[model samples]
Structures are given as structure tokens and as C-alpha cells.
Target: MAKVSNILFVHGAWANSSAWEKVLPLIGAAGLTGTAVSLSLTSLADDVATVKRAIALIDGPLLLVGHSYGGSVITEAGSDPKVAGLVYVAAFAPDVGESAGSLGAGGPPTRLLEVVRPDEHHFFKLTREGVDEVFAQDLTATERAMIFATQNPLAGAALGGEVTAPAWKEKPSWYLLASEDHTIHPELQKKMAARIGATTVTVEASHVAMLSQPDAVAKLIVQAAA
Candidate 1:
């Protein structure tokens, strides 16, 4: 196995780098260095660029770990030569010509979809109720509140942006499925994981599994790094 000394964490929509606060130390405890990128969430292209820039800063083999929309970012950025592997934590792994929106097109609309509200600029954010009831149900009341307050709204158009290529097509990948996720359906997660031929492990948690089950999520990241 390649020696992966660094891991870059890409957060999903409605979140910032703080989303990985609890998981970073755990990853470090496993003898690996981890950094979470705070995406602009302005556009898919921009997000991918942000990840690529982060990759350029690291010197050795690195693992890319993405959650939710961050998965889409890694799928696009993982093609870089420095990336050693990918870890998808309840995220979308879209292929070439597919956008995050298109991947979930036929699936039943989730409560999250119904609760998202767009600003005048077309950026989307989840309602507080959506955060508490759907997105992070497994988290505590205070934690959910903090998540709702600190969410970084994502541009609505980003969801429809298509990927030019998916890194998972060429790299070793692992997926940690949140079985109780209400945002991204579990079936969709299973399908994406299988499609990518990712080694998968399912956790009985909600959409924000990294926050709710950091240990389990970190464990898989360490395994991928190893």
C-alpha cells in the first residue's frame, strides 16, 4: 500500500471546514495529517480549483475525503497526480457528464429538497428546521443549531453543473454510507458506491455522519490512507 501522509477533507453543502473539527484530531491520532478545505460553494469549477490548490500545497501522497457535495468536488479534483485515494462519506460520486442534480433526478425528493430556500442571488440554504429534523437528526440540539447558524449557502446552479471526469474511475475509493441519511437516500449512496467499485461500510447515522459518527468516518479515512 502507498504511504499516504496527508488527507484533504472536502465538506458538503451547507457547511464549512469546521465540519471536520471533530474528525481531524481522530485522523491525526491515527498517525496522519488532515486538513479540511472551506469551499467557496460558488460553482463546481471553483470548488474543484480550490481542492486542486490544496493538493498543490502537499508534498507527498494524499487521500481526498469528501462528504455530500464535496464528493462531487473530489470526483473532479481527484484526477490530480498527487491524490492517492478517495473517501466518500455519504456523498455524490458523479461520472463524466453527470451533475449532482442529475444523479438525484429520478429519486424521490428528500425532505432536504423541500426545505431548501434560495436567496435573491440564487444561493441555496437549508431551513433551521431542515437542519434539525433532517440533515443532522443524529446530532445534539446545540450542535444542530450551530450547524444551521454556520452553514455556507451553496449556489443553486452548482448542483446542475456537470463533471468533466470522475477521479474515482481511476483511483482506489472507499465509501461510508449513512444508512439513516434523509438528505441523500441510502439507496442512492449504495448505487453510487457500487458504480465506483468503492469498498463500502455503512453507518447507522444521518446525513452528517462525519459530525455524528466521526470515529467511524475517520476509521475508513485512515484505512484508505494506509
Candidate 2:
């Protein structure tokens, strides 16, 4: 029988590697080590290098999963020979010649864009309210507040850069559509999924569905690894 493959998770903007904490153990239970990647989110080069470091650690075949902006990272990182498949969880799966910023051009979900502030380094971080309303909308009041306090600011340059090669165009792709996601509109998710020819599934959860609906997310990852 074939052995199970490793599952590497790349988290999106305003988040650290810990974003996949709840879902990691579930993936492990299925006999796959779920490695969570924290991108610099400052530059495409930095983020891709971070993902390559994760790829190098895996000795067997792998299933690379990306959520939100992390999708942009995996789109390039998944090109490694060890990467066997790709899973995008309401993540950006831009096609060739597409920039991450272009994906959101359909329209901003709400007025949250106004709350973003950039430092001298051009890294963008959301305000506390931005985190509560846009990101952790599915969490409890306490959970949401804590997340806001710990959120990381991503570099604005990450969004403007284009993905050189979209792994989805070369590899088998799977997409999880967060039906209730407020961060990236559900309509855009469908558009991205269809463009990449991904096998698609929908969940009525928020942006962080891996946290809010772990079992459902794990099932899909486990299936891809299997």
C-alpha cells in the first residue's frame, strides 16, 4: 500500500503559523504531518523562500495547502518535485500573469480596507476592529479580541507582485470555498476556483474555516494526501 503524504499549510496575511494549530493535529491523526508555514508576506521572494524551506524538510511526497494570501505563496512553492497536489482553502489561486491584488479587484468586501495602515517599511496591518470584523468574525468575542491583539502585519508589496507560475495549472488542485467568508467575497472564491480547474467543495464557515470547521478541512486534506 502507498504511504500517506505530508501536508504543509501556508497561512495568509495578518496571521502567523499558529493559525493552523487547531487543524494540524487533525491532519496528523490521519498519519500526515501538517506543517504550517509563516510567510514574511513582505515580498514574493521572501514568502517563496519560506515555503521552499518547508518543502526541503519533507522527505516524502507532499500535499501543499494555502489559505487566503498564502495561496499566492503555494502557487509558486508547489512546483517542487515533492509536492504532489495543491489545496486552496478560500485562498488565492491566481492563474499565469495574475497578481494577488488583481484577485481582489472584483471589489473589496467592505470598508475594512480603510482601516489598514502601513509602516515606513510598507507592511500593512489591520486595526483591531479590522481583525474582529474581517478576519475572526466566526470566533467568540474573547477569541476575536485576542486574535486582533496578536495579528501580524503583512508587507504591502506581497499583494502587488505577480505569481510567476501558478502551480494549479500544472498540478491537481482542490479548493475550499468559504461560503460565509467576509474577508474575500464568496463570489471571488468561486471565480478563482473555476479558473484553476480545481475540484471544489463549499462550507458555510468563515474565512478561517480551518479553525471554525476543522473536521471538514481535514477531511479534504486527508483525501488529497491519500
Top-scoring candidate (lDDT):
1
**lDDT per model, in order?**
0.92, 0.84
What is the per-residue lDDT of model 1 for residues 1-226, given as tens digits with 9 covering 90 to 100?
A: 4978799999999999999999999999999999889999999999999999999999888999999999999999999999999999999999999988888785556787777899899999999889988899999999998998999999977788799989998999999999999999999999999999999999999999999999999999888887
lDDT of 1: 0.92
Residue 204, model 1: lDDT of 98
Point to the candidate with the largest TM-score: 1
Task: Estimate the lDDT of model 2.
Answer: 0.84
Supply candidate 2's per-residue lDDT for 180. Answer: 82
Please report how far candidate 1 places residue 17 from its true position, in Å: 0.2
Rate residue 203 of model 1 by lDDT: 96
- lDDT string for model 2 (1-226, tens) is 1444688889988888988988899988887887888777888779989999989988888888999899988998889988888999988887776767788875556455766788998888888777677776788888777777878788878887788887887789889999988888889899889988988999988888888888889999888777
